[model samples]
Target: MEGVAAHQKRKVMVVADPTRESAAALEYALSHAILETDTIILLHVENPNAWKNPIGSLFKWPSLPSSSKVASSPSSEGLGNGAASLGYAGGGGGGEMEFLEALKRACEIAQPKSSVQTERVAIMDGKDKAPIILSHCATLGIDLLIVGQKRTLSNAILGHKRSGSLRGLDTAEYLIENSKCTCVGVQRKGQNAGYILNTKTQKNFWLLA
Candidate 1:
């Protein structure tokens, strides 16, 4: 049983999305399960393209400047810095307050366990999702990926909306089919947690908040 538990402590990487439930699922998985893994990396990707305003397309100026130009200027540097501030829930952390609180709680709970260490990474601009995630996972020698599966009739029928949820659709499916490591996807059912075993691993491990 000791060895079994030790083997189960494989490194888990949870990719962070802007969604609330995804963040909550990561918080729960880190606190409840993967404390024994080699490491838990919280990866958050911020897509600059997502923020591009359509209004900027209306004018075709002769000398168009990049966002970096505005961001680097002395006058706009403060505004840039201010806009990127991390917020906290208790009016201390900034924009990332909720995330920081979740991480704090997870860390506190994980302190008693000596199996895994946690690290958080905020990716500012990554265009390719699956390759970047897989590259990072490989670089870290990750054994598992724990992600939240949004439960719905549509998702159930059509599968994850992210094209390739964790790995690319094909790679993710292959992992579910062949990878030695497990991929656990959790779905929220009211206050309870329901999970899907995308791999040969165990299914439906309930969390006792």
Candidate 2:
């Protein structure tokens, strides 16, 4: 059994966005699911449309190399500070930078308490995020997939109109239906209950509450 476990190193992928829900998922994994030998990947999918829209300044396609190290400068701007420490590729818009910072911060907060290998990745493509996430799981041989669920005001209103049965968000729903590996969806517990890591100050701040 030890040999089998050694051969089957658990690979976990946490699909995160710039939301507290994503942080909650990572926090849960770090606290309970991850092992010392487990490998964790925090993945963010940049919307392809952002590149095409003239006004959309979120991210650009092929902006940086496939896997380039983030720059290390205090005022380098964007996610350079946190992402560089975590070895994330650079050359994205403010939104992308924010996403990277959030991912890096989550791992940082979790890293000190756990002995696990973690990395962050940004996918810039025109395809739907669900397919991209599913493809990564298949290609990377991920053993577990974790995602976060935070209901927006729109979602809440829609649910109220729909008799309290809310539809799953696109990414979570797709993974639940199609992923070959086990999937866990974490729901945020309270208002402003999540933590956000600031790339510039290298500090963490609690959200909402």
Candidate 3:
């Protein structure tokens, strides 16, 4: 089986969305991955409606501010240890900025110690996302699939009060059931902790700071 296969370099795919849950998942994957050389792929599925806007105004990359603006702005040195630096122009439309910013945050979290090669892919939503993710896993020989579990209205109504494990999102569940590689669902645990849920067994493990 693909999950049991031993490979020199492991490729991990993170299904990234513009949500705090997704950021938590990426942070968990980057921080806790066993291997330092793992290749992390950030995948974002774009909505078709995002392309309806005018290309010049909506899709154009914002120009960098002048040196005067930089000098006048407050220093970000005290923001944190590895605060995200946003200077480059990202591709795609307005929604693409969110994905790029998320990716940048993930990169900042994995800095200094981690030598993992990271890449990002923005897929145009011409078809279903589950199939695309599965195909990408097969083509790239992904060793593990990581995704965030966002709470829905149903989850909020019926709460995860039982305490065994919370159900994952549709995309995470689909990939967990059908993907060729191992799948992990990450959920945010309050402000400082992260809960890593195993997809197959539905077991919950806490990663506390």
lDDT of each: 0.46, 0.52, 0.55
Candidate 3 lDDT score relative to the true structure: 0.55
For model 1, residues 1-209, the per-residue Cα lDDT tens digits are 13456545556666555344454455456445554444566665445556645452232111111222333444443333221222223223333444434443343333334343445443456445545555666777877776655555534554544432445454334334344456566555454333343333443444444
TM-score of each: 0.53, 0.53, 0.61
For lDDT, candidate 1 versus 2, the one ahead is 2
**Over 4 Å off, model 2:** 1-8, 51-102, 105-109, 112-126, 152-169, 191-209
Q: Which stretches of candidate 1 lie over 4 Å from their true place?
A: 1-9, 35-38, 52-105, 114-126, 158-181, 200-209
Candidate 3 segments exceeding 4 Å error: 1-7, 50-98, 101-126, 152-169
Q: Give each model's clash number.
A: 9, 2, 0
Question: By how many angstroms RMSD does model 2 differ from the true structure?
Answer: 10.9
Each candidate: RMSD: 13.4, 10.9, 9.1
lDDT of 2 by residue, 59-149 (tens): 2221111112223333333543333333333444444444456455535444433334444445565456777888888988898888865
Ranking by lDDT: 3, 2, 1
Predicted structure with the largest TM-score when compared to the true one: 3
- The full ranking of all candidates by TM-score, starting with the best, is 3, 1, 2
